[model samples]
Every structure is written in C-alpha cells, then in structure tokens.
Target: MWCFDNQKLHMNMAILETQSEGGNIRDSLLLTCQSSSNLIFGIQPKQEPLIRSLSESELRQMPKERFNQNEFSSIKLSKDLKIRKEDIILYNRESGILRDSLEKDELLTKSEKERRKTNREKFKRALRVERLHFLLPKKEKNLKPQPALKIDWSKSKIKTNPDIIKVLKSFYTNRRDPQFPTGNQKLLLEKLAPFPIFSVENNLRQIILAYPPETYMKNLSDKLYDYYYRLYEWESDTRATSIGFFFFNPEDALMYESTIWKYGSLSAAELGTRLSFFRFSTAYKLNRTSPPEIRFLFIPDVKEVGDLVTRYRYQYGKQMKFHPNQKITRDGFADQPIYTIENVQLKQGLFSRREVSYFGELKDHKYIFFTVDGAESAWNKFRQANPNLRLPRRPNLLVYNFNSFINDCEMDPDLINQNFIFMLNREAYKALDKSKQDTPKVSDFSIFIDNRVKPQLFLIKIWAKRLKLVLFHAPRINEFPRREALLDGLTNFFPPSLYRVK
Candidate 1:
C-alpha cells in the first residue's frame, strides 16, 4: 500500500524533482511516469473550488451566520437585504439595470401611499365621533315628546262679574231720588224705588253743617291753621262783603246754581237733591276728588267775588245772602294746575294767594304727554285730511307741528299747566333737554326759568312743600290709563280732609 500525506506532498514532489539530477532512479522514474500520465490523459493543474452564488430569494431565506462578509461586501445593503417596492424605486432610480423594475414598482408604491392616507383619514374621523359622543348630553339624545299647552279662552277674556255689576247698579240707584229723575229713570226706579221722596236741597245744607268747626280746624299744621284762622277771623269781622267760590267741574257750578234757585238757600241741605247728578256727571271728567270739595275765599269786598265768578264763568256761580252774614266760598275746585297743563295760565289767575305756571316743551321722547283732547283733535284732523284713515285709537305720541302748541300756549297760557304738554317742535324739546328726567328739584325749575320768574318758582317750591307735591313721570305712550297715571301725582295734594267743609 502506498502511504500519502497531502500536506507534505508539495515538499516530497520538490525533493523528488531536485533528486532527479543526482540519480535516485526510482524517484526520477516516478516523476517521469506522473509527467507522462499528465500528458497522456490531458489533465490540467488543479485550482481551488469556486463558491456558488446565491439568488435573491435564497439570500433572503439564508441564515445570517451563513452569509460570507467578504463575498457580499461589494453588493449594496438595499439589494442584499429584503427591500420593499417603494424602497427599490426610491433608492435604485439612478441604476439603469433596475429602471424597468423600479417603474413597475412605482404604481404599487403610489397605491400603497394612497391606501395609508385613506386609513389615516378614517382614524381621524373615528376620533372626532368619539370626542363628540362624550360631550353631548344623554337626555338630549333620548328626548320625549311634550304635550301642547292649553289656555281657557273664556277665563282669559275680561267678562264683567255679574255680582260686581249688581253691586254698582244698586249703589248708584239707591242714591238716585224720585224728585230728580235721571236719564235712566226706569232703571233707577226699578232698582231703588219704594223709597222716600228725598229732598237734595235740605240734605246739602245739613251735610255742610254736619261737621263741627274742629273737623276743618284740627289736623292742619301750625302754618295752615294760622292761615285758615286768619281768613276765618277776617271774614267774621269784616263780614267780608263778598267771597270767591271756585268750582272744578262746570256741572258742579250748574248744580249749585240750580240748587240755590230751587231751594232759595245756599246751605248744605240741598246737597242730596243733586249730589248723585254731580257725582255721575263728573265721575269720568274730573281727575280730582268726587262730590265736589269746598275751599273758602274771604275777599275784601263782595264785588271781587263777583269779578272772580264772572272770570271763572262756567267754573264759578254766585248766590245772594238773605241774612246778615253768610258763608261765601263753596265746593273746592278740581281744576288742579298740574292736570290742566293748557289751563295752568288761566288757573293761575284763580289763585288769590300766588300765581304759578311752568312753561317748557318736554325734551327728547323721554317724557310723553298724551291728552284725550289732543288725541281726538289729531284723529279728527287726520280723518278730515284723508277721510279713510282708520285707527284702533288715536295714534300715541302723535307728532304735531310745534306751532300748534306754541299758538295754544300763546292764546291761553293757562292751558300749558296741564299734565301733558305737547311739544310743538322737536328742536324746542332738544333745546330744553338739559334737565334730567327726575323729580323737578327746587334748583331744576327755579334755575331753568327766567330771572324775572325766579320768585314765582320759589313760591311754587314753597307751595309744593306745604302741599306735599308728589313727583312722577307720565306713563309711556300706549300704556293703559296713561292719562290717569299722569294725574295721580296731583291726587296726593287733595286729601279727603282738605275737601271736607265744616
């Protein structure tokens, strides 16, 4: 058997070749034989074995440890490692070898990008829905239907109570007399008759003398008491030839005149005869107290009283004295200066003590005064101008030419003292708009008027203090009972005690 050590083969071969020249015939013979075998068989020299290259798929599946670093050093990491279509197109775009593949992958990558974008939008929408679900009230999501509301039409309407109507009718009818029948005589008789034949003339005299002097004399403050006593004493001593009597309602004047003529005496005995007539007729007309109150005036002479009666005309009436002495003044006047703004100037003349009048256009629309007379006049004028003009009521705060108010004031300054003074011009109101809408302070009206009228303003302030004039703003236009509310301020000035005569 031949022994072979492959590791020492090269050294043995070299030794054999070197020993060939120095004979060792067997070694030379062996070398010649190997050379002859190489020639004869056409055998080539042996070289190291070549490594097998892996395909792209095989490299991806190959274990990491099995990979040869030296063999893969020249290959790009992106090509050697598993690469997505998007990465291949992005990184290998410049390689002409991969141009076709990269172009094909471009479509896939675009679709993949769009798919991811769509998924992201869906996620955002879901998040928004979740957030809103947390914010909404649970009850709102399950709301139940509600029943319709109901109102009783009959109850809502202002139907007059039968009981109230019966009471009012009885009240008025009981006071009616048989001798002095009213327009509704049939109704009065049916409701109130089987009664006495009442004498109003005798009743008037009795009512006048019913109260003791103390009723009129007491409760008056020291200043008012002194004033009254002075007038009473003056009248008693001077037998003050004449006295001035002021009547608020024209009907009251008529009643007094008719009663005195019929009964032949100016006593309170006759009050009952015509009291109902006076009350019913003047109930809606006068804003002041009903059953015309009395205010006494003691003048130096009876002639002055006559002058006043004549000057007052419909508002005043006279009667002659049959006896040595008689009371001169009669029922109190309801004609308050404040209520009759237009009559203020004329009413000022009726004040024997002092004359006072406030004259100014209301500023802005802050204060509005609507008069029944003015509204009627405006409606009538409007109807005249356009015969077809229709309105529910007179238009409230109707704008009128300022000249009309100015002319009315100029013609009769007395009328300016009314509760409502129409502003003839917006410009004039703007001019007077400096004062605030509050109670007319002493300084407000006093400083506003001309220097010549300052004393009169002072006197007005003093009178208001004595009378306790309550201040109020008139109700807005369209307010129910606007006129009545405007008149309420003057009501405080006329107490029942002030109206009572001793």
Candidate 2:
C-alpha cells in the first residue's frame, strides 16, 4: 500500500511515496496536486485537518490567473508556474477542445476528463452580466410598472350579459362540434375578432384533449394553482423599476416561465420567451386564466399543411410523438420495432418542473410511414398544438410553402419517420459519417432533444398594476353558464373579480 508523507501539499508538485520499509526506497514519484482528490494516495491518518475560515482580507485575494490552458495538444510549461491537469482539461472544455490534457498521465487515468461544454462561453458572459448587476444602485421602491393598455373597454358600460356573451363567443377557440365552419376563414375572423388584431387566417381549433393517465398532478392537492405565461406589465420608463428575484429551484422555475413579458429592471432574456424560441416541452396550462389575446398565430418555417387522417388522429388531424432517447426512433411499421409505450416509462426530466409537468408513460403513441408531405404537415400541426399553447406571441395565420426551418437544416422531410422532433434527430444521424464507432449513438451526431426551460421568478411583474385575469377554463368546469362566466372574467385584465379559476 502507498502512503503520503505529512509534509505540506505544494501547489506545483506533491511527492507520493510507498510505506516505510527500512531505509531502502521501493518507489517514489512526483505528481501535481489539485482541488480534487484524484492524485492523492492517502491523507495524514493521525490528526484532524486544521480547517478554519479565512479572514475577510485573505478571502479578497482572488486568483489572478484567468482560465486559459489548453491540455488537448502538447504544450510546454514555463518555469514560474504549473497548472493541474484538471485546469488544462477545463480550458480545453471551455474552448470546445476534445482531447484531455492528462490522458497520458498514469495517475489521472481513472479521473473523469470528459465533460459537457456546450455553450460554455455564452454562460460565462451571462455570469459576468449578472455579477455586474449587483454593483448598480438598488432599484427605487414601488417602481411597479403598469400593464400595457391594449383596450379600454372598461370605460363603456355593458348593456347586457348577452352582449358580453357575444364577445366571449368570438374569443372562444375551443369548439366541441367537429363540423368545420362553413364560411370563409378570413371573413369569419373579420366578423368575429373582438380585439383589433393585425391579421387572421383559419380560426384556431379548439378541442378537449386528455392528459396522460399517469399525470403526477392528479395526486397534488386540489388547491394547486394552474401555471401560466402572462404578459403582466409592459415597460414604461427604464430609469427606475421594481426589484426582481432569482430562481434557485424547480418550483420557482415554473413561476419564471409563467412570467411572459418584459418589465422594469428585468431583462427581456429573463422573462418567458416566445414558443418558437422555447426549447422545452411547453407545459400547457389545462386551467388557463389569461384573456384570449391571440388568434391563430402562424408558425413560420415548415412546409404547407395538408389534412392528416390516420392513426393518432385528433379533432382536426392525426398527431404523432417521438421519444428523444433510451431507444432508437423508428417508423414503427417495420419488423425492427421500437419499445412499446406500456413497457417504456418516459422520464420527465427535472428541467420540466415536475410539479407543473406531465410524466409517467409516453401515452397514445401511433406512427406513420416516412413521407415528405406528411412530415411537413405533422411538424406544423405539432408546433402549433404544443409550443404556442405555452407562450403564444403574435398571431401567425395559416401555413403556405414556408421553408425557413426545414430548408435551413437541409433535411429531407421524407426521411422523417417519427414525430417532427424525432425526424430531425434521425435525419442528422444519417448525415454523420460512421468514422468514430461502428454503431453511432444519439450523442455522436450533433442532435438534441429540446432542452427544458429553466424556472424563473416573475415577482416584479406580479407585484405591479391591476393586471390579473383568471384563465378559468378547464376540463372540470363542465356546465355552460359557469364556463361562460369564467371566460367573461378573463376577457379583461382590469375587470372586477368575478370567479375563481377552478
């Protein structure tokens, strides 16, 4: 067995020695010491480590060296200094270099040199911007912003409930009847649009959809509030604003995504981003409270939509889902079948904010063969149905032969076998050459399942103006008048408190 002497550990070099056996030396070696206990064979066994808090002055002595060592390629160290192989590995990681500095080191052979370095530079910049924020003068008290006044219908008196009901009918996106509307789509929107919207196309489809049976939310207390992404307050003056909060956990992350718009003091990047820009599974709020501000917002990019009428069919057309990992994505029609949903438990990552997301089994999955037209159509429908529901911005009307996304990626829509996301991954895998390994894994190709949205705090926005609206529509509110009344309450932000969202 080997043992380390009681001599002080050096920043540059440390001596590793075997147990004492007479005066003859068995083996002796010099190794670099690092913060991690990788090179050390043993610690001094007889005495406690003299750990104590450093004084404030001593703590202020920050290291002068910026992280700039590249261990990937061979480099000679100068006489004045020595850096740990871990620091060299970190430098290569930060700069997107793949080779490990200490891969040759016999001692560091067991050390984990591989690390995730995606967007390292971007994160460092974000960190710098945040640190600078602390030095700026603290925000003034009560600098709460007011909600942007899109309408002042509050001034005029409503003559009757039917008048308000008429307005509610216009905003309603969910229509239970399967029959497609008979009139021209544009004409219908022009006649029915309550607010002065910029444009319209096919009115958005509205239908009740079942949540996965394995929902974690079902066990939560009935008093739980449905989460939302709301445009609470629009900024006015930038001089002074309300103090905002930072999120440290999953629960508060839900609060951040729910805060949709920019406000005083808060950067636009901090607020909930638009659905198209969002990388996470847009956690759709079954119990909505926001005023229906948008109509069918056209999703730019993908190809034109044709009618889909096969397996996994919904009200308008069939929908498909693709799993990101743990099994290879497939068309599900071949002899080489993917794992069945019953056997495969879908993991809702912690990033999904478990308190607000659906986990359990990936439910109601059905497949279609690879086709260019169908893939394009499904991609459009999936994005429309899923993403925008979480953070809808401007109303993008119907789709034409839009090709910004698919063309940009140069992906052949026909190769897409599973859902739009899965198809993208499959296409990318095909694009890569099998130079590294005989069997390429998902990580080999530069492909990604969508990353989850981080939780954020929307304290500043919620604290400002009389901008609350209860998105009271849910599967549980079955009766007609009660549903209508809930809609009526959500139709205006400044309206009197009328009904609970539940």
Candidate 3:
C-alpha cells in the first residue's frame, strides 16, 4: 500500500517498500521469524518524485536555489493582536485614520496580495480574541535535515523472543477504559472545541509518520529494540495511570521481569527515557505543550500487540515546508487535499485466542482539543454534523497521583514526594543481598537511591529489606542542590534535555 500522503513525506518512510512488481506490500515486508513488526521492518525504496503540486513559478521564487525549511517558521499572530492600553482615543484619531489610509492606498502584486490577504484573514479572525490562539495542531517544527538511519534486517537483528510471544498468547488480554477527555483538567472544558477524529478513507488504515526525522525516529527506535526483543511499551506504565488502562498480568509478573533482564539493561531503559523526553521537548509546536488531540486507545491490549503492520488511512489537506534533505518532502506537500490509504495488515498468526482479548474497535480513532472563544458554537456544529459519534464519559485523562507529578503549591524546591510503589528489579535485590554483611546481627546488603541522572529510572527510594522501590519525587531544582557559595557542582551532561518545566 502507498502510505505517503498527497503532500510531502508522511510517516516513517523506511518501514515500507514499493510493491509495484508484485502489487503487494505484504510480500515486500519482512515475513521471517518476526511474525509481526515492532516497528515496521523498513521503509520503501527512495522515491524521486518532486512536489508535483508546486508550479514552476513558485519554485523559482524560493530563497535558496533549493527549498528552505525555515520558509514557514510560523508567524505568531497572538503577540501583535493583543490590546494593552485601556484608552487609546480611537488610536489617537489621526494616527488611526492615517494608518488605515496608507495601508488602503498601497498597491501590491498578485502574489504579494495573496500572501497579505491570507495573513489579513487570520488577523480578522483573531479580532474575536487575541490572535485566535492558533489552537490548530502543528505537524512540523524546524529541524536541520538529517538522513534517515537505514535498518538492515540481516545485521544485528533482534532475535525472536519466544517467551514474549508465549506470554502474550497466554496472558495478554484486551482491555479498554472507555474514558474520554478524562485528562483535560489543565485545560478548561468550556473552552474546548470538539473535532472529529481524522478518519481512514475507504477503510484503509494508513499510519503517517509526520516529521519522523524531527524526532530522530531511527536513533530512538535503535535504542528501543535489543538483540532479543523490543521495548515497544516501556512507557506503558507511564500511560497506564494516565489516560491509558492497566491490566496486571500478576500470573507472569516475576517471569516477565526476568525475561527482560535476559537481553536488556536498566541503562537502556534510561536512554529510552531520555529519548522520550527529547521527543517531548522537540516534538510539539511552540504554542502547545503536547499534541492537543491525544489518541487514548479504548483497547489497551491491542496496542500491546505492537507487532501490527503499518500504512494508515489519512486525509492530506494543505501543504507546508519541511526538512530539506536529499529525496523526501523537500519541495513541500500538495496544496490540495487527497485521501490516500497505506494498508499494512495485522497478522494474527497463531495467537488466535479471542477468548483472551476478543477484538475491540480496532479501527476507531478518537481525538479532542479545547477552544476558548467558540466553544458553544463549535460543539453545536459538532452535535449537528456527527450526531451518531458519541464522546467518552471522561473529559480528560485522570491519574492517581497525577497532580503530584508537578508542584502545584511550589513546596520544597528540592524534593516533592508522592506515593509510588513498584516491585524492585533484580539489581535492587542484589543490592539488598550485599547489605547483609558477614556480621550475624546485620543483613548482608547496602542501601542506595538510584540518583543516576536517568529521566526514567523511576526507582527513588529502595527498602533493601522489603525489596520495594519507591518513586515519583518531583524535584524542583530552582537552586541546584550544589549551588550555594560552598557548592559549585559539576555541569549538566545534556543540560535541560531531561528536565520538564511543568
């Protein structure tokens, strides 16, 4: 299936290959021991098609002889639109009239006029509020073009994990929270605008990788998969308590931990966390902290089956400048909307235990965001447009100690503690064993807190005796612990890359 959208490169391109010869992408897809893909095996062959939509006239006007990523460095309308003075005397009467007259009298070329008109329209809409909070989701953030890292299946491939396959077949059951907008507390509901989720046209599921390079998908993906298995859902725990569902496979808890230790390490998990934080820092647009419309799955277990194939159903509307590397999306995307589907079928293989997780709504997509000015009107339009589409009961995602994840009251800048309990890994158990010395009165072990600059090393306090790791300490280092006249600490490694402001 051709998954690339109407405009620019979409999704992780490498996971696919043109099947024009056989007329089947599945045949080209890796179908070896890996029953399914943790990450779609690889991208299609390099495509040379230019932005066929761009006119010869427009291409000539580009600043560089070639395309420029900064060409569309978003123009922030909110800043100029805000009104500060309580009294300006009709813009000082003369000043207002003179400014209006000068603007009306100025003559401009057709192209210039079109550009100005587009901006003016945005300005006019912003009149309803300060620069109409572009609240629209942003897809691209400026990133220097870098080549996509190529993956060769024959070299250093992840060995098949029979245990995980067995475990999923035996224990992984499908689960859903059926919750919606449950986590939208930071954002007020009255200000929200409900938009229908982006649909899969013609029932084809195309997974578009918007700006995959911007997040360094290759490097991130590299750290995710080991020689034996992939850490597809290492962050599953983070989402489990927030917006996502959690099912305790207690029957296989200890076994699962031991299995992971077979191939990966805690350091790998830390690197994964840093990469995630890096994505969080660089993935979103300036106006939004996170993507506004988060897709919280109704069926948690389905996603656990990260082994599904790729290619998605998508609607590409509007073109924007993107990364300027060698071959993909450099010239920009199509100006018109096109519905294209890149289908990668999920192979159920031998794990046909519907008794464990009978298929849920595997194709449904739900998305949401908030609007300040037209909340009522937006919902009214939504109600009239899609009467059949129902919203989940929860407004936003909810977390057990979600609030404690941050310092709302701004308490101790150094340490803000919360209630967290997790089973200690084998490393902690080993530390406990060491603490018990040869002395008969003492347990042979040592006590230590995993203060490694790890962004995801969740273990904060460890009780060697009970072998329980306590975590989630919101540390506010307004004054780094080693910042006084008496303490000038070692400098930050990546600095701020691992830290979150909120």
Reference-based TM-score of each model: 0.15, 0.16, 0.16
Q: Which residue ranges in model 2 land beyond 4 Å of their true spot?
A: 1-157, 162-267, 270-366, 369-502
Regions more than 4 Å wrong, model 3: 1-245, 252-259, 267-502
Residues 316-340, model 1: lDDT tens digits: 2221111112222443211221112
Better of 2 and 3 by lDDT: 2
Q: Note the Cα lDDT for every prediction shown.
A: 0.26, 0.23, 0.22
Model 1 scores a C-alpha lDDT of 0.26
By TM-score, is 1 or 3 better?
3
Q: Rank order by lDDT, top first?
A: 1, 2, 3
lDDT of 2 by residue, 168-229 (tens): 55345432211223233223223223211011000011111111111221233211211111
**Model 3 quality (TM-score):** 0.16
Mark the regions of model 1 whose C-alpha exceeds 4 Å error after superposition: 1-273, 276-374, 377-502
Query: Tens-digit lDDT track for model 3 on 147-263?
Result: 111111122222222446634633342212212223332222221112111111010111111221212222434333311121222211211011211111111222222222222
